[model samples]
Target: MKVLHVITGLGIGGAEQQLRLLLRHLPVRSSVVTLTNPGAVAAGIEADGTPVTHLGMTGNRDLGALPRLARFVRQGRYDLVHTHLYRACVYGRTAARLAGVRRVIATEHSLGETQIEGRPLSAGTRALYLASERLGTSTVAVSPSVARRLAEWGVPPERIRIVPNGIETDRFAFDAGARRRTRQALGLPEDAHVVGGVGRLTPGKRFDRLVRAVASIPDARLLLVGEGEHRAELLRVAGECGAADRVLLAGACEDPPAAASAGPALPELLAAMDVFVSTSPDETFGLAVVEALAAGLPVLYVACPAVDDLAPEAAPGARRIGESVPELISALRGIRDARLARLPLPAAARRYDIARSAEQLMTLYDQAVHGTPLPAK
Candidate 1:
């Protein structure tokens, strides 16, 4: 079946990476449409043999994009239209309906209790989201917490499908050679205690807390991977915490082929670190947390209901911590001298394997198209 996937932008991010991974494993013909900013992830998707079309949407007020997208969707005659992220969902669903594509679906990749799209919640935004949601046949929630949040937001429970975000388990497996090479490349001592966090350097991520936490732990180094508008602010915060020299910012690792490799990419970076920590108060699904688990590293996270709702067996090395400098410092010191065991990946990680998720999504697509019930959980 032909499926048209729409997304707000093709920037390097969890949702973009997840889309790339899904396209690789999906069994049907697929193509992509990006509203704007066809960055590195778009190149990777094109390399994978999926065609990508960019709509040059200047801003949210660009109504012309609707007709253009609808025309493309109609010409493609796709069996399904799937949208990701917010702006794309709003526009794609409407375009798909205008194109007469009855099988429409969207994935809720980011949503938190207090924040929607990294901003404070507002009534107008809620109305727009709810109104656009009606144009789709189903909404895929990346975690159970996200599904619950959607239900609370007035989405019918039956319309929400719980499909967790996934990763390539084998790609992220720990490698000793990678650890050595990555540490050497980053100019970090091989024996230094490293605390790693991966995500956009945004205010909502609360990376400032991590900078302060690293400062309290003498000799502890911080490695933050990913980029955003908050880079300058993060640098200032690091300097204020007196951990500027101790912190290393690798910027955004966008190429999935390189990122998936054991070479000095994201996998190596994750392996080089002693532990992974996340201070973000919200997430629809914690992709980095799962990647860390797949790499056999212990994790400390705060306010991530996505991870908190997981069964213990799925992420055996995960530990919950608050987003405070004191708590993080204490946690770092507690794990400083301890030798962490590299355990087999948890069943929870396996459940979200990209290949498995793709197959389940195909099932959901069948249900959406033919009104068939999903197989028993």
Candidate 2:
């Protein structure tokens, strides 16, 4: 079927990258429309042989963009419209109805208890979300945690489908040659214990706490893989704690199968690390934690619904930690002193494989178009 995917922006964030990965495995003919900045992930998507259209939306209230987007959708005569992110959901769903497309789907990628996409949730925001939500056929939550949050916010339980965010598992498999090369390229000592975290360097992510925790451990280095407005503050925190030289704020790296010019892709960095840590106390799915588990690295996380919702045996290498710097430091020291070897790829990693997620999504697409009932979970 012909499907058009709409999103707020094609930047290097979790939702954007996830879309790129999903398109690679989906069986239907799919195109993309980005309402704003079409950054690295957009380029990667185009490189993978998909047509990407930039909607050139100036700001949130760009009323002019609505007509333009609606006109484009009508011209394409798409069989279905799938929207991602917040702004896209509101506008895309409305525009799809205007363009006479009835089968519309929205995937809520980042929804937390107090925030939607790192922004504080307000009464007006909820009203707008709920109002726009009615225009779509269904909403897909990336995890059971996000599904619960949506239901609590008044979305009908029947409208919410749990389709967990997935990864190209084999792409993240540990590689010995990549480990040595990546460490040397990043100027890390071969014997030094590397503590790695991957996410937007945001205040909510609590990466500053990770820096301080790594600082307390002598000879430990911090490798943060994403970029954000919080970068300067994190650097200042590192310098204040006298760990400036021990930290590497490697700006956003693409997911694996990335071009050589994109610098070290995420898997290479994962290969060079001794342990993975997620300082964010509020996470929808904890996708990075799953990726780390696929790399066979032991994980210490403050919050990971992806792992927490699963049975303990699903991810034996992952450990949930408390939300304090002292607790983080102690956990790091414990893992370091123990010199834990890389564990086996856990069942959680296999469960969230991208191919499986694509199959589940295709089932939803079939249900939407053919009036077929979804199979029992």
Candidate 3:
């Protein structure tokens, strides 16, 4: 069955990467469509020989692509239209319905209201999301917290499915050579402890906090590897912390994994790091957290809404910090190697790895198309 996965953009992100894994091994005819330009994820998908359709949409209100997309869906006669993120979910599902495709599934990737300009959606937008959730054939949540958040927002519990985010064990595996080369290239001191950090440089991510956390740790350096609107503020904060010299703000690493090797990439970044630090106080699924674990890195995460619940016992070294620099410093210094190795990957993580996630995505496609529950596996 032909399936069309819809998303806002093909940028390097968890959702896009998840789609890439699906495209790689979903075991069915599948394609990706982006309302925006084909970004990093698009490049990877195309390199893998997967078909990608872009609408060249620069803004959220671009409706010009709708007709073309509808026509394409009609002609392709795809069995399922899987939507990711909010904007694309609305457009894809609406267009799919108009194009006579009944199976429309949406994955909710965020737990928060997704508000803009310090405001929740206007009344009309609220109605629209509510209606869409009710009308959607199925809703998949990357974490139970996301599912709970959706339910709190009015989506029925039964309509939501919890599918934990995963990593590509093969691609995101441990690599020592790449790690060494990456460290060498970075010109890191022989004894400097590396801290691998991932995620957008945004407010919710609290990258500034991370910079501050490591400021007091002599000879410790942080490598932040993502981009967002908060760069200026982060830089200013880093400067104020007096630790800018010790920080390696590697802006927008396209593929940490690809840059080095299995280990050199994100896995390498994660594996190479003496510590994996997540200061993001509110993460939906904490994709990078799990990826760090998959790399067998010692993780130190601030207490977020969903963090403690994620393999709590295994991450016993995991400590929650309450808005204090001293607490952050304490948490960073607390993580030991033995505690990190104890964190066991839950069974649900199997479904997240590229291959397994791809298979589960195919199964979800089948369920979406046929109105049947996904197979138990």
Least accurate 10 contiguous residues by lDDT in model 1: 255-264
- Any idea what lDDT model 2 has? 0.94
lDDT pick, better of 1 and 2:
2
How big is the positional error of residue 90 in model 3, measured in Å on the Cα after superposition? 0.4
Can you tell me which runs of candidate 2 are displaced by over 4 Å? none
lDDT-based ranking: 2, 1, 3
TM for every model, in the order presented, reads 0.96, 0.99, 0.88
- For model 1 the TM-score comes to 0.96
Worst 10 residues of 3 by lDDT: 255-264
Q: Is candidate 1 or candidate 3 better by lDDT?
A: 1
Per-residue lDDT value at 294 in model 1: 84
Instruction: Report the lDDT tens digits of candidate 1 across residue range 113-145.
Output: 878778887788779999999989999998889
Report every candidate's CA lDDT: 0.88, 0.94, 0.70
Q: Compose the digit string of candidate 3's lDDT tens values, residues 104-173.
A: 8888776554652123546676567778776578888877777877887778787787766666655555
For model 2, residues 13-110, the per-residue Cα lDDT tens digits are 99999999999999999999999999989999999999999999999999999999999999999999999999999999999999999999999998
> Hey, what RMSD does candidate 1 come out at?
1.7
User: Model 2 TM-score?
Assistant: 0.99
